[model samples]
Target: MASKIDPILEYDFCVAFLSNKWHTPPSNLKDFVVTSIQQTKSNATNMVSIISNFLKNKSFDPYVKDCLRTCFDLYSDSVSALDNAVVAFKNKDFDTASTKVSVSLDSPVACQGLFNDKKGENKSPLTKENRAYFQFSVIPFVFIQMCRIHN
Candidate 1:
């Protein structure tokens, strides 16, 4: 989906170069990649807001509540890590940026695991979307770091 792909399109070239799973991107690619990192930053900020709102308004069983709390913490941590990564990038500290981005990637896995551990099914819609958002959030930085390696 273009919506899914748009956030990380700028780094697509780096991904192709690193993975050996290369393919030529379509024309008008620049327009697609034209979305700046600021948009991802905004998305991450919005994630934090959404999670906080959900946590504040929702009530559930204690275990499920705990799980939600954990997810909230992870999302917050990811937002911080992503912000730090951006700062590192601006400072030309690519290694530090990469490390921060790598750390942020773990939030989704942990959050998803929290859901599965609670039950086989019936994951909350908010958590599902948040997990996907967390995954999407890290992708651009991944490409940016990879591009740094190549260049």
Candidate 2:
């Protein structure tokens, strides 16, 4: 129930999102879903970034803020890795990129209670870099939906 957006309903929504964005004539629902799922996974981080941009670039909505808060804690470890990469890059240590990616994957930030006591600080469900991760989350669902349709 955490992700209140119902997968059942969102499958249809995803199809719509796809039809609007892709102009190619897919062979069938299977192809369309497969392509769209791949693209969504590939661009997931981009979508997260876009959503984060939407949050920070504009006033925060209460509903959006709540939703973001729920998910942001889950992303902390990933954010720290991004921070680490920046430090390594600024120090001209290119060799550590692999390590940085490793840390980000394993040491994600704890987003629980992140906004509990903070006041006057802008809360993002995702930071600029974290937004890029959103795409990663969307692709699998679409892929599964495609399978369902094909089957």
Candidate 3:
């Protein structure tokens, strides 16, 4: 179904958060959204700020900054190092996969392709490079964080 809100402003899982119901993973349309967030390993607290900023903090017009902070924080243990390891494992390139991540900016794909070009390994640098993660998490959370921000 076409959404009443623009894809830019409209959260990916707008219907689910709007309805305030359990997001039955893999079945609910919101599942895709939750899946995306889970896959990204976004920081819980920073992410909530972006979500709340959109849903509650209608001032300062905080947009992507909130999301970027969340993206960079790796307390969840799903950082680029882990990603490269997983990708290498899948491709059988454990040698490169085992390398510790220390990225800068413009090499997110490096999470899978280890070329010793430690760039884009972390979201913090990229966030400063380009305020995109804000849109990444904030927009999506608008549909998921219907409960409350933890921190």
How many pairs collide in each candidate, listed in order?
Answer: 0, 14, 5
Ten consecutive residues with minimal summed lDDT in candidate 3?
103-112
Candidate 1, residue 104: how far the Cα is off, in Å: 2.3
Q: Which scores greater on TM-score, model 2 or model 3?
A: 2
Where model 2 places Cα greater than 4 Å from the true spot, the runs are 1-8, 47-122, 125-151
Alpha-carbon lDDT, every model: 0.58, 0.44, 0.36
Error of 2 at 121 (Å): 10
lDDT of 3 by residue, 1-151 (tens): 2233234434454444345443454464345444434433343334334434444433422333454333334322334443553454346443343232222112233221321234544323233312333333333333333212211
Q: What digit string (tens of lDDT, one per residue) describes model 1 on residues 48-150?
A: 6776776776566565667778877877777677777767766767778767766666666676677664347745536656555654655555455454655
CA RMSD (A), model 3? 16.6
RMSD (Å) per prediction: 8.1, 11.8, 16.6
Per-residue lDDT of 24 in model 3 = 51
Q: Give the C-alpha miss distance for residue 141 in model 2, angstroms.
A: 2.0
Which regions of candidate 3 are displaced past 4 Å? 1-26, 42-130, 145-151
Cα displacement (Å) at residue 95, model 3? 41
lDDT of 1: 0.58
- State every prediction's TM-score relative to the real structure: 0.64, 0.35, 0.26
Best by TM-score: 1
